[model samples]
Target: MTIATLFAAVVRAKPITGFIVEDDPDRPQLARSIGLLHLTMMGVGATIGTGIFVALTTAVPEAGPAVTLSFVIAGITAALTALCYAELASAVPVAGSSYSYAYATLGELPAFLIGACLLLEYGVSCSAIAVGWGQYLNELLAITTGWHIPDALARPPGNGGVVNLPAILLIGMCLILLLRGAKESATANTVLVFAKLAVLALFVGIAIAHFSAANFHPFAPKGMVGIGTAASSIFFSYIGIDAVSTAGEEVENPRRNLPLAIILSLLIVTAAYILVSIAAIGAQPWTAFAGQEAGLAVILHNLTGAAWPAVLLALGAMASIFSVTLVVLYGQTRILYAMSRDGLLPKLFQRVDGRRGVPRQNSYIVAAGVALLAAVFPLDVLVNLTSMGTLIAFAAVSIGVILLRRSRPDLPRGYRVPLFPILPIVSAGFCAYLIVGLPADTYALFAVWIAAACVIYFGYSIHRSALA
Candidate 1:
């Protein structure tokens, strides 16, 4: 109970030998089925969903016409952490992403804490992404049928509706695809990612065609504070970039492909986000971005003064949300599977289908939990929560990079973080800065979640951990 004892207890880490060396005969194995292209699509699938599709409506109002700069700021933060992610993911090549990396570097207790953060990140993010699907689906329906879903069924109760049925249904579809197996899920994600990207390209093309210089006047109306706040807010859109690491066990030539996918996906999404932000701001006044549902589709509808283009964008948004949710849900299940294999949770989480090679029970549990959140919470509530969890996990990854470099310098790595300690330290600093900028309520909720996780860890995980 003394300080020295407590410090030592928390720092008791696992050996940095193998990510797949579990002695548990019953532990499920993941097939090495994902390649560079599919893994990059997984990253794109996990990101580029609701952020550009829906988060813009919220972020643009904060930074005014300067929102594109907000994308740059957030992208830099994400890229820093991603570089750290790439290094750890390459060397570790495990299912838990940051959690596994933390275990390898920061010890069992810290790893459990990071694992808790990821549980919150992936679970809430999957739901948050799905919640916007209803809005876009309604948009598509309204344009084609002259009618849309009633608010009670389309929006969450927090948004002045009873439940979000479309979001639940979207989660249901993802559940089916995930249970089929990893390769099938990744294949579908690749197709969906391309479809959504093309749709975004169409959006940017239209926005530029109608670009007005008037909208760019008085850029940064709210100045530095506003831009920083908006960057912190929109960073939620970039949450799933680490998802590439979650597929470590399933990636082919993981040391090479894992880092490659992580970096490639970040570059691709960062460019897409920045381009779309500029185009949207150019096409319309930043003041007009607030409180719009299916905002991209709405922008097209207003710009072109037609319904067909909006409907087309709405269809794309649906595809984006579905792909994002599917991949995030997949990430969540893999995380639980990893934790369970390490004896952090119940064995049920690690149980897999003998034929399909996925943690079947884990998928069903994660889908049901995400569906409930999507059905009940408003998009705004879940968005900040997801960001909060991801920020902490990101900071952990950066710190993990530093810790592992000192502890295991001889370890073979497929990728080395450019500039070494400087980048990782800066990455952690950026994540901390954004964490400080989040709303007070977000901090309070995150504290409560962490407290709950500590309780579970002390009461259950610490006693059952494989390293114990």
Candidate 2:
């Protein structure tokens, strides 16, 4: 068949309603066991990492105390897109998240592209966070003792070091947990989430003692451009807010809980981010945050004049990064599984391990690839690329909400976006503005990635797609 014919067939494929998966229907049964609390914890597990712990340190120095305002900007952008996600997620109530929503509303080609963009967003972000964890762990160890891991073991090449052994090891550990099953992985995530939160609370509490109003004197020192730039970069920290939407198919009372989880998670996380940023800035001069690793640890050391708090923050960061890796990796595998079930990719990706009720092979494949990237690549490059991919996907989902509302008004939606066209329009505009704010090279790289994805869709995905 011609490519156009294949694309049309893929687009016309019947929507698979409910949790039934024909090829591996057993997977849905495996998934249904996950409940609302576990799903919310998954959001907590993923949302609390890198952004608050690391990104704040990086962004605050650039935006100054107004980094608090950047957090607000980023939160608003995420909240708007998240609302659109809630409506689509509730209406579709499917396994794939945005990919599924795009397929149901846009077309198969769009779905494939969305899936590809998500690969960059989730998979690459996992790698980035893992690398960030490595840096903090090394710093934590060095602080406790005068000695540190050799550059060869803890740092990537060309940064005056070799492979990041700790990062690779962390990714591998998360992979094993994920292969065992989602419930087991979620349990571990819950524990880590609480530990991380407790440590952050300690930081906030202690830092308050050192807070000086003097820090507020030059709050907007960087001006509007600085705040906007930092907000765009820090936007990566808010990426996990959509973790709730991804679990829509598995969520109980998704119509109620999905919207609740999305909004609640965003609110809690945003509040935490703003509080943490303010605390960190207030405790130390904003200029000191620049180029700092394990920044929370450094702040603790400066505040208490003791090593204990820094050590605690480092330990918390280690656990937080591991949880982030597991959740994001899990998300990537599930998205791929959804695409495979749709026949947009090879069926091998959709296969589930009957005993574990997980997509074992796919999980392994994703983990291996991400681990390598984490071990070898520089994190700064990976994070910016992740932000680019995420911006495009977020923009698409926001626009997808509008298109669906127009085309499928009769479709049952559990949660409607508060303001139909206006909210979605604003969401899309916000995402677009963030996308434009990224460095020129990031935009070029994103273009190349999307173009490559289109080529794959036409050359392979379109022809092999189940619908075709």
Candidate 3:
């Protein structure tokens, strides 16, 4: 068949309506045992890791004390995009997230592209979190024993290290848990989420005691351009807020819970981030924060003149990174499950391990790929790529909300974005602005990624799609 014919068939076969149908015949049935609290915790689990642990150090020096302002900017962007996501989650209430949203409103081609972007967004983000986890693990070890894993083993080769063994190991452990089942993964995630919060709270409290106004003297040292750039980087931290929306099909009373989880989680994370940024800046000059690895641990060591606080922060980082990996990995598997069910990918990915009620084969494939990337790739590059994909997906969702309003006015939307076209339009514009602010290298990478995705869809996805 011609490429156009194949694409059209795929689009027709799995029309957006397929997502709204109550039961999907080809997909495995997931238990709706997760409640609002669990979902909220999941958001916390996914979001609290890299932004606070690693990105803050990178951001503080760039924006100085104005890094707090960057957090607000990132939060606003996340909140706006989340509002659009809330409506879509409630409207579709499916597992595929933006992929499902695109399927419902745009068409199969757009849905395929969204799915491809999400693959990079979720899978690579997991790797990035694992790398961050390794840094913390090394800090914890050094604090406890006065020794660390060799620098070569602790970092990726490109970063002047022989290998990132800890990152790969962490990803492996999370993979096993994910293969076990969703409920188990969620429970584990909930515990880690609380641990991360507790440690961060402790950091905030202790760091406050060392507060020095001198650090705030040159607040915006890098100026407005620096603030904007840092905001773009910190924006990656908010990527996980949408994990709530991905759980829509499994959420109880999605209409209420989906929006609640997304908004409430955003608020909680943003508040914690702002407080942490303020505390960190207050504790030391912004220049000291530059290029500082294991930032929280360093702060603790400086504050108490003891290794205990650093140890605790390190332990927390380990748990935080673990939880982040689990949730992001879970998201990647489910999105692939959705695609496979729609016949856009190998049917093997749709196979649910009946005992675990999870997509076992898909988990293995994703785990292998993510683990490889975690071991060999530089963390910064992976993070920026993830941010780029997410920004595009967020922008698409915002536009989708506006398009759906006009095209399917009669459809019952559980939650509507406030102010309709205006809200979604603003949300789209904000995401686009962030995208533009990304470095030229990021744009180059994104272009290549999208081009590869389009090629894959035309060559394989279109012809094999269930709709075709």
Which candidate tops TM-score? 1
Query: Model 2, range 1-468, lDDT digits (tens) per residue?
Result: 777766566566345452334434335334655666666667777778888777766687778889889888888899899888878877777667788878877778777888888898998898889888887888788888878888898877755668999888998899899988878887888888789889889999999989998987798998998898888887877767656666655567776777667776677778788888888888888888887878888889877888888899989988888888888888888888888877778887888787887888888899899988888887677778888778778888898889888887888877899877999999999998888778888878888988998888878877776666
Positional deviation of residue 236's Cα in model 1 after best superposition, in angstroms: 1.5
Clashing pairs in 2: none
Range of the 10 consecutive residues with the lowest summed lDDT in candidate 2: 17-26
Please provide, for model 1 over 1-468, each residue's C-alpha lDDT reduced to its tens digit, 9 standing for 90 to 100.
578866776788878765757544665478899999999999998999877999999998888988888899999999999899989998888899989999988888889989999999999988888889999999899888989999999999879799999999999999999999999999999999999999999999999999988899999898988899988888878866778899988999999999899899999999999999999888888888889889999999988889888988999999999999999999999999989988999999988898999999899889999999999998888988998999999999999999999988999999999998899999999999888878999989999999999999888887787776
**TM-score of each predicted structure versus truth:** 0.98, 0.94, 0.96
Residue range 177-287, candidate 3, lDDT tens digits: 987777788899999999999999999999999999998988798898888888887788887776777776677887778877888888889999999999999998888
lDDT of each: 0.90, 0.80, 0.84
**Following a full C-alpha superposition, what root-mean-square deviation does model 3 have from the true structure?**
1.8
Error of 2 at 314 (Å): 1.1
After superposition, the stretches of candidate 2 with alpha carbons farther than 4 Å from their true spots are 1-30
- The RMSD of every model to the true structure, in order and in angstroms, is 1.4, 2.1, 1.8
- lDDT sort, best first: 1, 3, 2
Whole-structure CA lDDT of model 2? 0.80
